[model samples]
Target: MFAGAGSNLSQQFNLPFWVGTFGCAMLTILVSFMDFKKITRVLGIFTPIIIVMIFIICAYTFVGKTYDYEALDTVAQTIKSPMPNVFLAVINYYSLCAISAVSMAFVLGGSVVRIGVAEKGGLVGGTVIGLIITCATVTLFANIDNVKDADIPMLQIVKNISPVFSFVYSLTIFALIFNTAFSLFYAFAKRFAGRNKKKLRTVLCISVTIGFCLSFCGFKNLVALMYPILGYIGMLLLAVLLITWIKEKKNILAENLIRKKMIHLAVKKYDEDLDYTKKDKALFHRLGEKSVVDTEEIKSEIKNFVKETGTENLKPSEPESQSQSSDSANN
Candidate 1:
């Protein structure tokens, strides 16, 4: 999207940026609902090829066009002035917010997986945290007036701190872009894999190649073309996600209630008898109702209990009893 924005802004506030950004954003969301592992593997294989293509294009563009520092300065000056149309400014601002929010949602999704927090509260909390971080970062660094002229506004700020820091910042940016591209490729591959490794490879290679080719029309021009488009698409997706969440709230709550009840019932069953049949134990195991359980310790105790008392006589025990059994077994 940033690439698209840069592209569009370079071309005189045209439609291309909006189109590209929104299109890519929609594609990202569509790809995300897919199986991730397959997508990732395919991306892993295709990324090097894509990068090579992008490098070639960059080389070509750098040689073909004169560096337009003066034009860049003019653009910066134009953006510094008040936007002629108040409505357009409002729309642009809202679009920026939507893009930020959607990006936050993706970050939240990744963090939840990493931290093993898949609950509703976890999703909400992660999203909130992501938004806070994004907003704070933008507030700290985004100088709207100078943003128009800067090739890489955020990176420029880092350079001001130190050249070494700027170089590191550039590395980070490269890593992030590569990571996101690979992740996107992986997502697409998973969705379309269908047990055909050859087909998956082909599709991923093609997509990355296309993206790489597109990237070299000039990064800033591409970004200018993409961001507004993405912003609009993000706004739509946000509405849908919000509506779905609202509609499912009651059902989600009810499911959690059922899970809590099942946990309570399993704990009760453990109290009723010192010995439980394998089937009875399996019932509690299948319930897997652990909003907060020390699963590692539980697994260790279960393993020892199976080895010592045998699986046939294994019983669900209270948390304290479970701890005691584990300690005794270890001793």
Candidate 2:
């Protein structure tokens, strides 16, 4: 971040770029070293807060200003490159601008982010809300000043309304920058932190200092170089994630279909033997009952004949009813 680089404070105080750069980066360093989970959650809310502030500021501008800007404020005067397609041009602008802005939804663990995202109708829904808010903000700020030469156009807009407003807006800007800076630096430092507390602090300082030094290269230059590269990287990551999601869904659907087919086949075989399953209830009770009754009489006859004959081998305690019951149970 440029921090207070082109703000009213820097201009009034005649501060050097290095001063603002180092100050912001150093604050970010302290933020990185903080072991506070509450701080992360608090900082996480800052982006939404920032967006709300933007909406508030936009409303103030609408109510405060009666006259229109003589001309639209253009942030970039020199259009070094141009795209022909209108849709693509808009897409390109947002893709670059959103690099850090949209990092809030990410940066946390993906699963946790997904859980949080679902309540707001998932990631795409949140994005649409963000876009609507962004469009309103752009419409207000684009005409903040007609004189496009000022590096800090928003500062001039608020200043025109009131010094009090300007000062408050400036502080808001600083807070937003600080919040964003904390996230970025902390993310970079946390990677190397692992379990080394002492080493992590040293690395964190060095990293912040290095970032401060890098900031001297100027925010405009960095944005110019970094945005396009980040845009492509973001696109690639999105493509990979979408493709993987599609593949996973396909696998799940395939497994479900196979399972259904197996169940269907098993049911078909069961249906074929449905007649056999109902043998005792359906067929045996009707047709086989008389034959079964005839067999009992025949068994009684045999038992009586065996008893009447002097058969020493057959014990009197041995019952033919037990044998017949066993046969019926087997069937």
Decoy 1 TM-score against native: 0.49
Candidate 2 segments exceeding 4 Å error: 3-14, 62-86, 101-106, 110-137, 140-147, 195-200, 248-331
lDDT of 1 by residue, 46-97 (tens): 4444344334333433454554566655544556323446476556545655
As a whole number from 0 to 100, the lDDT of residue 199 in candidate 1 is 76
Q: What lDDT score belongs to each candidate, Candidate 1 first?
A: 0.48, 0.53
List, residue by residue over 46-124, the lDDT tens digit for candidate 2: 5565566566656765665564333442433333434455476566655655555445434453213113233454466
Name the runs in model 1 displaced over 4 angstroms: 1-77, 80-116, 119-147, 194-200, 254-331
Best by lDDT: 2
